[model samples]
Target: MSGYCGASALNRFVNDLLFFRNRLPLHVAEFSSYGGDNFDEAVQYLELWIRYSLSCPVAKLSVTSHDKYQRWLLPKGLITSEHLTALQLTRVKTQDDLDFSSCVSLKHLKMTDCGIYCDRIMSPSLKRLMIAQCHFIGYARTQIYASNLILLLLVDCMGMTPLLVSMPYLVEAFIRLGYCNDFCKHSYEIGDCGDESCWGCQFYEDNYGNNNCILLHGLSSCTNLELTAATAPFIFRKDLTRCPVFSKLKTLLLNEWCITNNLGALICFLQHSPVLEKLIIQFEPPEIHERLVEIGGSYDLRKQSLVLKDLNVEVRCDDGDERVHKVLDVLGSYGLSPEKFKIQRPPKLTRARFDDTWTSGSFSFEQEI
Candidate 1:
C-alpha cells in the first residue's frame, strides 16, 4: 500500500471487522504504526474510525507510534467513552486538564514514555495504573483520585510534581522515584523542566525528594510495598512529622541501597508495620556501595519495639560486615532465631540422591503465635 491509499485501507479494514453494517458493539482496537511515511496520518484515521464506531464502544485500546518524536495526543472522545475497560498508550502526549469523568468502564491504564500534562486523573472505576518513564508536567502536584485503584507502579518517571493519590483500595505498589544516573540531565533534556540548580538540589527538595510525603500518605493503605533505592530515601528522613501507620502492610522489599545505608529507615518500617510477615532484602552488585557510610540516616532506634508476627527474612549473600549484622541483629532482637534467616547466594547444586561426600546440618526457628 502507498501514501493516501494506505490510510484508507486501514479504515476499510476496521470498517469490515468492527463497524460493519452500522452495528456498534464493544471490541478491542489495537493500532500500531508500521514505520511508514504516513505514520501520523494513520493514527489520525484510526481515531476517526474510533469516533465513528462509538455505538460499538471499545473495551480495550492500545495505540503506539514507530517514531519516538511523533507523539499522538489521546483524543478526548476516547477518554470519555463509557465502554473503555483498558487503555494503553506509548510515545503519546496528553492534553492538559484532560477530563476522564465519563470513563465508566476503564479498569486498567498504562502509559510508557508519554507526556502527561493533565492536572488530575479522577477515575472511580480504574483498578490498576502504571506509568513508566513518563513526564508529568507544569504542576506542583498532580492529583490522582482513583478511589478504586488496587495496584500502582511508577518506575523512573521524571518531571512529576508531588502526587496526591486517593487510592483507598490500593493493595500493592512499586515505586522507583528517580533515574538510576543523572536524572535531571536526562529529564531536562526531553521535558524542558530541569535547570542548572538541579545538581545542587537536596534529595528531599527535588522532584523525587522528601516532598513525597503526600505520596506516601496516599499509599498508607497498601498491604505490600516495594521501594527501589531512589524511592527509599523519601522514607529515610528523621524529620517525618509522624510515620504514617501502614495498618495493612505485610510484605516489604527494599533494594541494597536502602539496606546498606539506611538502617534507621528499615527500623522505622519494623516499628510501624505491626503485622509485617515477609521482608526481602535485594542486593546490588559489589561495586555499588563501597564508599557509602554506615547507617547515617537520623532515626530513633529507641522508638523501635517489635509487634511483628512470624516475620521471615531473606538476605542476599554479600561480603559486607556492618549491613549484614545490622539486619540480623534487628531480627534477632525481634525474637527471630538465626535459623529463620537464609542467605541467598549463587546457585549451588544439592544432590539428595548422590550426596555421599558432602554433609549439611539443618536448623529451624519455632515461634508460637
Candidate 2:
C-alpha cells in the first residue's frame, strides 16, 4: 500500500478480492499509489481495485496518487455510483464527459491537486463540495450546476474561473480566484479591448454583452460569502454591472479587487445587498498604486442607501496610512459613521510595508474591534 508491489503480489491481492465470496458491506475504501516502473500495469491494478470497491458499494471512497507527472483517469463507474456518500480524490484526472448527475446518493465531494478536463459538473444530491488547488485543463470555461449544494469552497484553483449555475440552497461559499484565471490579466476597465483575435477579450465581450452572471448569480442565495481575487480579476468587476441582489446575504467579505475600480464595485454591492449586516474588507496596499479602471461610469454613492450593523477593514498598513484614510473616506461618503466600523491590523506585523506578494491571514472578523 505504501509503495509499488511486485506484479505477482498485485495479482494475488486482486485475485483474493475478486474470488472472496463474503464481501462485507464496505463502509470506506482508500487507495494510495506512489507509482512504479510499469504505468499501464499500475493503471490496470488500480482499475481492478476501484471496480471491486464499487461492487462492494462503498459509502466513502478516497484515492490519492503521488505521481505528479501522470494521473489516473477516473473510472466511469465511480461517477455513477449510488452508494458513495463521501468521495475524496487527489492528483486524479477527470475526462471531459465527467458528470455527477448520476450520483443520486452522493453528498460530500472534495478534490485537491487534481486535473479537471471537464466542461461541466452537474449534481443534484451534492451538499458540500470543495475543489482546491485543482488544474482546470481546458480552453472553455467550466460550468458547475449543483442546485442543492450548501457549502462550497473553490479556492486557489488554476484555470479559467468556472461559471456557477444557480445554487438556491447554498448557505456559505468561499471563492478565491487566483492570478492564473483566464481574464485576470486582461483589462476590461476601458470597456473590452477591441481585439478580435484575442480570446480573452472576445470571451469578455460575449459574456458582458449577453449579461451573463458568471459567478454572482449562483452565489446569490448564500447567507455568508467570501470572494477574494488576486490583483485584478475582471469577473467580479464585470458581474457588478449586472449584479444580483444578495437577499439572503448577511456577512460578506471581499479583497482589493472590489475597490480596484474607484470603489465602483464596492458601492454596487452595497446598493444591491439590502439585508447585508456585516462587511469585511481585506485591504491590499499595492492596489493603491495601480491605475484605477473606469467601470459603468462613476459611482454616485448619495443615490444608494446602506445600513450595516458592522464593518471591519483589515489592512496591512498603519492606522494613519493614506490607504486606510482613503477607504474611510469612501465609506464616509456612503453615510457610514466611524463607530460602525473599525480598522484592524495584525499585532506582530503592524506598520510593516506590504507588497503584492504579502498574503493576509484567514478572512475573519474575530479580531478585536
Candidate 3:
C-alpha cells in the first residue's frame, strides 16, 4: 500500500476484500513483501469494516478483515478457528496475522513469508494450501482429510522435514529450491549437498532438503506441476514407477540453467513422454551462453513417443549469442531424428516470451535456436 498507501486506496479498498469459510483473504496474491512493514494495520481496518457491512448484507456474505493480526484475535485468540473460509496470508511477518484456530470454514489457504505452526488439524473443508518462505516450529502436525483438496504449494520451506503426504486428492503441487524470501530463486542452504545423497529432496521432496526414493514415488494426486530444480535430482527413476499424467505432461519446462540433470535423466526425459507436445529448455551457461542448439535440435523425440507432429522443442538463447550447429547434430546422431525438427528461433525476448501459455501451447519454428 505504500505506493498507494494513502486514504484514497482505503476508501475503495474496503470493498475489495472477500472472505469464505470461517477464514478471510488477507494478502490477495503477493507471496512476499517489498517495502511495507505495517500493511497489517491496513488489513486490520478492512476486517472490522467487513464485519459492519455484514448486517446489511442479504444474499452474499461479503465479510472483511483489515489484515490486523492481534486486533482481530480475541480473548480466545482463535479467529480462523470458525466461520472462516478462504485465507490469503501472504508476506505477513506476524504469527497471528491469520487466526488459524478460528478459521473453521477454511477451504483455500495461501501463505508466505511468516512463521506458521498448527498444533491441531484444521477445517475438513480446507482443500488448497499454498505456503512458502515460512517456518513452522514445534513440528506442527495437523491431520486433515480434504477429499475436495486441490493444490498444495510450499516453496523455500527450508524448515519442513519431508513427510509422507497422504493428500490423494491434491491436483496441483509446485515446489522449488531457493532463498525463501525471493520465491523464484534459491541459493544453497546446502547448495552443493548433491554429492550423491541429496538428489530429489530439493525439487521433489515435500520439504526443502534432498528427497528420498519413497517421496519421489508419492506424487499424491498432483497432475499439474511447475518445478524448478536447483540441482539434479535422482530419487526416483521412470522405470521404478509410471506417472501417466506427468509422463505425458500437457505442458513441461526444464530450467537446467544453474544445474543440469545427469545424462541418464536427460535421456530419460527425452523418452519419458509419449504425449509431451511442448518442451522449453532454458540453457543458462555460467560464463558463456553455451548455445545447445545441437543437443535440443537433434533429439530422439520419437523414442520418447513424441512424434514429429507432436513435438515442439524451444532451446532458449541469451541475446547476442551466435548460431548453434552441433547441438542439432547430436539429436540426429541418436534415435531422436531431426525429421521436421527446426531450430525454433523464438521472436526477440519480449513479454510474450515470458508467457507459459503460448510457449507451452504451440509447436512452431518461428525463429532459430
Please state every model's RMSD to the true fold in angstroms.
9.6, 5.7, 9.5
Ranking by lDDT: 2, 1, 3
Error of 3 at 58 (Å): 12
State which candidate has the highest TM-score.
Answer: 2
When summed lDDT is taken over every stretch of 10 residues in candidate 3, the lowest stretch is 291-300
Best candidate according to lDDT: 2
Taking all chains together, each candidate's TM-score versus the true structure is 0.74, 0.83, 0.50
Question: Residue 347 lDDT in model 1?
Answer: 31
Candidate 3 stretches greater than 4 Å from native: 1-83, 93-105, 117-128, 135-147, 156-158, 161-173, 180-223, 230-248, 257-262, 269-274, 288-311, 319-334, 339-369
- Overall lDDT per candidate, in order of appearance: 0.61, 0.70, 0.40
Query: lDDT per residue, candidate 2, 241-296, as tens digits?
Result: 66778898877887667764457778888788888877877754554535345543
Q: Write the number of the candidate with greater lDDT, choosing between 1 and 3.
A: 1
Clashing pairs in 1: 24-55, 24-56, 25-56, 204-210
Q: After superposition, how far is residue 336 of candidate 3 from its true place, in Å?
A: 2.4
